[model samples]
Target: MKKPKPLRQEQILGELNQAPSLRVAELARRLAVSTETIRRDLDELTEQGLLNRTYGGAVRSLGTEPSVTERHTLFVSERERIARAAVPLVKDGRVLMIGSGSTTVHVARRIAVEMKNVTVLTHAFGVATVLAINPTIKVIMLPGDYHASEGATVGAHTVSFLQNFHADYAVLGASGLGQDGPADALIECAAVYQAMVSQAARTVVVADRSKHDRLFPARYAHWRDIDRVVTDAAVGSALAEPFRQFGVGQVLA
Candidate 1:
């Protein structure tokens, strides 16, 4: 009946996202854990640079990303539509490098039902699990340190492992989309995403309308690095012009 440390810490970070800060006593009561256990979790999270510890609790770290569970619940309909639009871009019997994110998971689900005889390389547990439902799809997981918040593997090992093979397409999700390009809140994830883009022939970025004009800590790809962008709405010229100038395809899903 106890939550795993990673899940617990993710929940704590989720709480901070809802509010500016959270007290240890409040979290203990809500999580059904002791104050000491909460403190230990807080200590570990702070050491990992995921949160800022206060006198008796923690605050959201600057530029901290929301947990995958948290992100999965927002823009549900938009993400599905984006996936539906993006999946058709894939042809059969090609290799894909899929990045980890809620939007990318939707893309994977669409791929599972619609495509066959394809090979997928991914660091995301959720993306791999979804694609496994299709017997025709071969899923290869990349090696790295597991990041619980994002439910993905990321580290130098993951980036290095990508050099072994090239992919036909690299499908990625963005924490924020700006003129600078699709960025990620986590540096480790950005590194993996950047490597994926380089190793693939073309790159497709999937993001909802909410991410437009937002900036994050790591800009994984520039406009020239992207082959296509699939989003829910038509952004203004500031964002759209760069895609045009770079000859990147824009899909308004």
Candidate 2:
């Protein structure tokens, strides 16, 4: 059966999340729809501010982060490896605070499958959902205004709520990982991330290679604030220098 227009449009955005740009013909072929249908769907999604029309097909809207479902389609293998590397850092029966993002979702999956008797506090609906699969894990949802695009909660409410508890570790994902440290594309999320960093005994940043050297507006923490970074990218002098300088450990997956 053919998917409805709304579902089909969502599938289009998911494809764009895997690869930022899309071509109409390819989208039509993959979705089993006519080119004209794909074009119309793209046009409607663009008008709705979910995506931007390009010369050929579409792209993610400027300054807009893809939804968690869309982001799950991206960097699958690398994210899996990074998640596996991060799992060894998590001890059994510890309290963890995790931030929102696709990579963090991968980490949550690892915690579900490989660990037990752990408590997780998060504002991301996706993270909480994944952790729920593990019977031994305790999932705590934080209070805040929900951001649908990211599938997470953010705002002063979320940050304030984090103040009441401390965790053994705070696992976070970043939009950019530069020499200065980890940063988020959305300013609202940065505050929640900063709060988690301050309240945890240690902080780990999980990011893929694409985030390297990029600069985003909301700098969550300086290098000194992070305890370690887990990624799939090979660390060269440029990336290694900052970690070494700040005494932050880098784990390559």
Measured by lDDT, the strongest candidate is 1
Off by over 4 Å in 1: 1-62
Per-residue C-alpha lDDT of model 2 across residues 59-127, encoded as one tens digit per residue: 776444556676676577789999999989866339999999999999999999999988999999989
**Deviation in angstroms for 116 in model 2?**
1.1
TM-score of 1: 0.76
* TM-score quality measure for candidate 2: 0.76
Instruction: Score each candidate by Cα lDDT.
Output: 0.88, 0.86
Per-model clash counts, in order, read: 0, 0
Pairs with backbone N, CA or C atoms under 3 Å apart (clashes), candidate 1:
none
Q: What's the TM-score of each model vs. the native?
A: 0.76, 0.76
